[model samples]
Target: MEYFKKILRFAKPYRVYALLNILSNIFYALFATLAMISLFPMLAVLFKQTEPVFEKPIWNGISMGKEYLMEYLNYFVTQKSESGSPGDTLFFMVAIVITAFFLKNLFGYLAMYFITFLRNGVLKDLRNELYVKTVELPISYYSEKRKGDTIARITSDVLEIQHSFLSILELVVREPLTILFTIIAMLSISAKLTLFVFLFLPISGFLISLIGKSLKRKSDKVQKEQGYFLSILEETLGGLRVIKAFNAESRFSNTFKKSTKRFYNFSNSLLNRQNLASPTSEFFGIAAIGVILWYGGQMVLVEKTLKPELFITYMGLAYQILTPAKAISKASYGVKKGNAAAERVLEILETENPIAEIPNPIEKNTFESGIALEDISFKYGEEYVLKNFNLNVPKGGTVALVGQSGSGKSTIANLVTRFYDVNEGTIKIDDVDIKNLKKESLRGLMGLVTQDSILFNDSVKNNIGLGKKDATLEEIIEAAKIANAHDFITALPEGYDTNIGDSGNKLSGGQKQRLSIARAVLKNPPIMILDEATSALDTESERLVQDALEKMMRNRTSIVIAHRLSTIQNADTIVVLQKGEIIEQGSHTELISKKGAYQKLVEMQSMG
Candidate 1:
């Protein structure tokens, strides 16, 4: 319920719809009760049991209103019957019943109509917030979490909340009011029988509560297992090439089948328990009705304390209570199921972003001097990835970082981009701490081109234009030409408009890399970070991409993390790293002369 209230805050924007639903439900409840109570006069007309009243009943105070209204109705019916045949009176009573039922259904439809907006509105807003948070959260957060699990929370679990929790909106107001009005009608017909109903109700309620006790826990397990299998499906789809290459399709399939089998068992358990709620409550309701029939029978037949027509109407109203009671029980189970989904969704919404920007952060928009990393130490968990690492890059000066895998070369790129903040020490840009800058403003001064290319399922033009929103067509062409991608792009069927397919699979490796460079060139930032950008390409592709990189790096401050030693020979400063520490820093010519780690790496690469 605590989580439910939190989710309800989203309903504030659509309060008008909620209010309309509540108002419609109120009228629906009134008509529902009145429709059942109309049965009394019809039965009197059918049985010819109505007593004729000689004088009109006078208007009385509120306390005796029920008695006065009944007398007045009987007087009216008697007068109508005296003027016409009994068949005419019977027809009038049927018309009244039909009219009452018509209004009841009309209001019921309106209630559902209004609630639809509120329910769907909450679903849309919740999904939008989840997407925003997914993009805003640090990349490190995903290192320990499953992508498919997050996808499940945003998609399936949110839908579960809509189906179950929002359904409570319909139940909380309509079901309870239906039961309330029905109970009131039952009491007016015969307080004694209504009191008899009270005796079994608490017992029935106790039993129903017992069934719902473990429903939430079981539902939680089912939702989690859903996420688990969805994670496996996402992983399997993303790595299908590897699975096929290794001939591991059967292994993954069996794993998926096992997960789905468990999900089936858990779901059956949950739904079966939910299914029991309906019959359990209905059985108790019918039991209460049976006891009323026996007890109320003695009063009408033997004791003569109740009228025959009124007793029949009282039985009808008593039965009416059962439907809403059954509904309330079922809705309680839904609430339990929905509560579990709500908890899962709120877990992501309520997660505190560790890399959150500070209040009133400095919005640095320009770079003048240089980037300085002084005495920085960082770690993913316990052991440090970079311990007391230090480096500097002057404005408009090209610096190259060379290292083996896990030597903290990429970590420097990550820190410079503020993807992960340093665990200790400070990174200053132009004599101001980079942490003080607004993240967007800080990132605005740099462009990144990774080894993967990272193209989306969009047009070739749109992929390149991602670096600079609303870039002109001419600008896109010029950027492509600079990256040596213009000729190949124009050769495609649709030229710049050619769709790239998934991850740009429609293009060659070199073509995709060149498009990535084109994107970075379009951004045209003062600082460029090339992260092993040519490592995955063939010699021909590397030569073309390297030429593009050199063209883009002119008059720009660049941090190049290179795998191929030959690419950085012309860099203004070459810094060689070994296990998070700088072993050498000089020009490529100077490093080759030193006969140290740099010279050894170059020799090893040349020999290979």
Candidate 2:
């Protein structure tokens, strides 16, 4: 309910629709009670038990509204009895009852019709807002979360909210109003009987509430287990090749089975609790009906205190209350289940994004001087990955950082692009601190190409144009040519329109790397960060990709993080790092002459 209150604002926009629905429901509830009460007069005519009334129907100096109503009905029946025949009176009463019932259903349908807009509107807005928030959240958020869990939130849990929570508007509002109007009609007929009906209600309600007490907690556990199994299934599908290659099918199957077994037990418990609502509520309502019969029968058979027809109408009204009461019992269970899903969705919508742009940030257009990492330090957690790091790549100069794995080579590239902020010290670009610049303006001046070719399942033209949206077709071709991807693209059946399958799996490793280069080339920013761009390629592919990289880096300020020694041999300055500290810094030839860390790295690579 707390999370539901948070999402109430989304439903505000559709208040007009909800209001119309409520109005329709109000009329429907009123008419439904009238429909039941109308049958009483017809029963009086059929059973020949009509009450003979006095002129003014004034009883004990108080005007009985029921007697006045009965007087009016008797006047109509008496007029028709005099006009043609007794059958005419019966025909008139039947027409009135049938017309009232038809109208009851008509308004009921209209209420549901109007509510459809409100239900689907909330669903659409919830899904859209979830999508927007998912993308706006920082990348660091995903590092600690499973992708499948997020997927379940947006898909399964949201759907549950719609079904359980949003649909409550229909059942909770209309059905309860219907019950209230019917109860009022019953009370007007005989307050004592209405009071008796309510006496049984509280006991039934208490028992129903008891069944739903732990439903939310159980539902939350079940949803979490569902996500766990989904994540395992996602992982199994993604890594089937590894599982098969290592002959670990049984191992993964056992793990998945364990997860699913827990899901099964939890799901069964949740469903078992929910399944209790209908039967228990119906059983209690039936018990109340039995008590109504036992007591009301005495009033008719022995005391002669109540007329048979009015008692029959009273029974109809009492029976009507049972449905909404049962629906309320069911809806209570639904609310409990929806509470869990609502909490999950609100957790995402209410999450504070850690890497958002500052208020009134600087708007730098282009780099003029260079990018500088001045005594910078960073860490993913408590362990420092980059400590006291210092580097300068002047405008139009190429500086390469060559080191073994875990030496913070890629961290330097990440900091340069502000993909992450440094924990200590500052990174300045063009003599301005990066924190001061608008993130968009700062990123507009740079391009990045990671070793994993991050190509989507899109067309070749679209993938390249991502670097510079709205780029012309000719510009795309020119960039592809610069990346040495034009030949392969042109050879494809659809050329630029060829769909690069998932992660460009349709293309070769070299072809994919070339396309990634083409994307960066199309952007043509002043500064570029290539993080092991050719690391995963074979020798031939590396040479081609490296050649394309060299071409792109020409006359551009580039920070290259390379694992291979040969690729950065011609860099203007090559920095060597050890244990998050700069060990050597000079031109490639100068570093080789020093016979230091750089020399030892080159020697080891040559022997390999």
Clashing pairs in 1: none
Q: What are the models' TM-scores?
A: 0.98, 0.96
lDDT of 1 by residue, 1-608 (tens): 89889999999999999999999999898899989889889988788777799789998796677688689878988899789998998899999999999999999999999999999999999999989988888999899898888998999889989988888898888878988898887877778878976998899899889999999999998999899999999999889999999999999999999999999999999999999999999999899989988999999999998889888888887888888888888888988998999999999898888887888999877789999999999998888888898899999999999988998999999999999989999999998888888999889999999988899999999999997898999999999999999999999999999999998999999999999999999999999999999999999999999999999999999999999988888999999988888999999889888999998999889833
Residues 83-152 of candidate 2: C-alpha lDDT, one tens digit per residue:
7787888888899889988988898899889888888888899999999999888666888888788888
Root-mean-square deviation of every model: 1.3, 2.1
Deviation in angstroms for 60 in model 2?
A: 13
Q: Candidate 2 has which clashing residue pairs, if any?
A: none
Candidate 2: misplaced stretches above 4 Å?
51-63
